[model samples]
Target: MNDFEFHLDQFMLHCDAKNLSRKTLKSYEQTLRLFQFFLENECKVTEIKDVKSWHIKKYISHLRDRGKYTVTANENTKVYNHPDKRIDLGREISDTTIANYLRNIKVFFNYLFQSGDISENPVKGIPVIKPKRKQKELLDPMEIKRLLSAMDVTKFHEYRLWLGVRLILDTGCRVGELLELKPQDLDLKYNAMLVRNPKNNKQRYVYFSKRMSNDLKRWLKYRDRFSDSEYLFPTIRGTKQNVSNFEKTLKNIGDSVGISVTPHQLRNNFAKYYLLNGGDMASLSRILGHSSIDVTMKAYLDFTDDQIRQKYQRHSPLDNLKL
Candidate 1:
C-alpha cells in the first residue's frame, strides 16, 4: 500500500463487511490513526505493513511518555461534577485505555500479517499490559438484604423490576449474563438457567434457591406486561436489550434500599454470601461459570476464611465431643 491510512481504510472495510459493531470499528480506527501518527512522527516509519513489534512497542512507550492518560467520567455528573469537567481533559490515558489501544494495534498487525500484507507478525511476541484491577467493592448480605427489602415490592414498577435484583443476588451472574437470559434458558423444575455469552464467551449454568424459582414464576407471568417478551427480562421494546437499560434502575434500587451497591457488588455478594454459608468454591465457580476456581478465590479470599472455619466446625472430630 501507499500509506498506513490506506491499509486502515481497508481494515475498516473488512470489519464493517464482517458485521463488527460500530463501536468496535471506531475503536479500531481511532487506535490505528494513533499508531499511524506514532509511526510517522516518532519512528520515522510510514506504512503499517512495514512496522515491526519493536516499532509498535516504541509507539506505545512514546505515547506513555507523552503523558497519555484518559480521565474517568463522573457517574453522577449532574449531581457531583461539572458537566464540562466530566469530559476527559489531559494527555494521561487510563490503564484500561492504554490496554485497549495496544490491543487494537495488535489486532491491526495480526490482520496485516494474516492477510499477506506483512511477511512477519510484529505482534507475535508482544504482551498486552494488564492493569491490576481495582479491588472489588462487595456488599455484605445484610447490606443486600437491606437494599432488597427496602424496595417497596407492592409498587408495580418495583415488583416488575424485582427479577433483575433477584437474579443478581441469587445467582451471582454478571449483568450481561442476567439480561441475556431467554424463556428457553430457564428450567424451573431444577431452578437452573443457562447463561450464554458470558465473559470470554464462557457459558455456564446458574441455579437459584427455590424461592428464586417461585419468584421467577410470578415474574414470568407478569413480565409479559413489559411486552410479550421472549427474553426472560426483555427490554422496554421487544428487540434485543443492552445491559445499560437496567443498570441505572438497579443502582437506584440499591440507593433506595440503603446500600451503596452496583450489580457487580451484588454478584460478588452472591458468591461471598453462599460460600460463607458452607458453599464450596468449585461448585460456586461452576454456578458463576468462572473459567477457573482461582478467579472465585481471588475475588473472595476473605470468604474462604469463613469456609475454612465452617469446615472445621462441621468436620472436626473434637466438635462432637463434650468439652
Candidate 2:
C-alpha cells in the first residue's frame, strides 16, 4: 500500500517483462523487498521520494555491522519484520555480498529515476566495489585421468558419471546444461551436442573430443539396453538425474582421489586447458554460451603465474621459431 511497496512491485514487473532468468528475478525481488523493509522499519520513510543517499548509506553500514551467522526465515521477522527469507549473520559479510546488495539497490533506484518516481538518484555517487579475486583450482591432465580411471563402469550411474564428467571437461558445458540434455541433442558424428536451454536461454553447440565420442557411443548402447529415458543421462528409474546427485557423486570421487573436485571446477579446467592449447576467446565464448567475449574473459582468464608460465613456453615466439 505504501509508495515504496508499489514502486518495488512495478520494478519487478518491468524485470519480468524483460524476461530475466527466474534466479535473477528472485534475487532482485529479495534485495528490493529487504530494502523496502529497511525503509519502513529503520528509516520510517514510507514515501519513495523521501529516501536520501544517507538512508542508503546507513543501510549499507547496517549490513556491515551485522555479524556473520546465518539468520533463518523466522529470525528475519525479528529484524526486518519481513518473513519467509533467511539472511547471513555473525562475521562481517564479504565485499562481494555487499557489492551485490549495492548493485541491486542501484538498479532499483535507476528504475525509479527513469520512471520519474524520484527526482534524485541516491545510488549515483556510490563507487562500484571490486572484490578480490581468488585463484581457482584446476585439475591437471594426470589428475583428470585419475578421476576417469577411477570410475566403475560396471555400475550404471558411474558409467553415466564417467561420460558426464568427460563431456564437461571436453566441452565446458555447464552441469545444468549437461543434465538437461536429451538423446536428440547429441550428434556423435560431428562430435558435438546442442545446448537447447543454456543459462542465456539461447541454443548453442558444444563439441566433444573424438575420445568422448567413443565413450558416448558405448554408453548409448549400454543405456538403451538398460533404461528407456529420453534424457541423455538418467537414473535407474529412467528419470533425469538431479544436479545435487551428480555433485554428491563427484564429491565422493574427489574425496577418494584426495583432490576436491566440482562440476564447475571441471568446466574451469576445460577452459584453462582449451586456452593453453591455443583455443580462441571468441570461440570459447560461443561454446560456453556467454553473452559476450568480455563475460567469458572476465570469468575464465584469471590464470595463476605458474599456469601463465606453462602456457608461455608452448607459444613463445623464440621457442616456436627454432632459430
Tens digit per residue, CA lDDT, model 2, 1-323: 98888888899999999888776888788777777777777789989889899998998888788644343223435666542243633668888888898898999999899888889998889887788866678887788889888889899988889989988988998898899899898998888889965345778888988988888888899999999999989999998888889999999987898878999988888898899999999999898888899999999999989989998998999989987
Note the Cα lDDT for every prediction shown: 0.74, 0.85
Return the TM-score for each candidate structure: 0.72, 0.85
lDDT of 1 by residue, 1-323 (tens): 55787888888999888777656887788778767766776678886667887887887776676653332222343455443453454556667778998899888889888899889989998988897666555565577567778667776556646668878888888888777788889999898888885444558777888998988888877777667777777665666557665677777877775666677777887887787667888999888777799987876665445556775787567776855
The residue pairs in collision within model 1 are 68-91, 68-92, 68-93, 69-91, 69-92, 69-93, 70-92, 70-93, 70-94
Worst 10 residues of 1 by lDDT: 68-77
Clashes of 2: 7
Top lDDT: which candidate number? 2
**With candidate 2 superimposed using the best TM-score fit, by how many Å does residue 279's alpha carbon deviate from the native?**
1.9
- The true-versus-predicted C-alpha distance at residue 316 of model 1, in Å, is 6.3
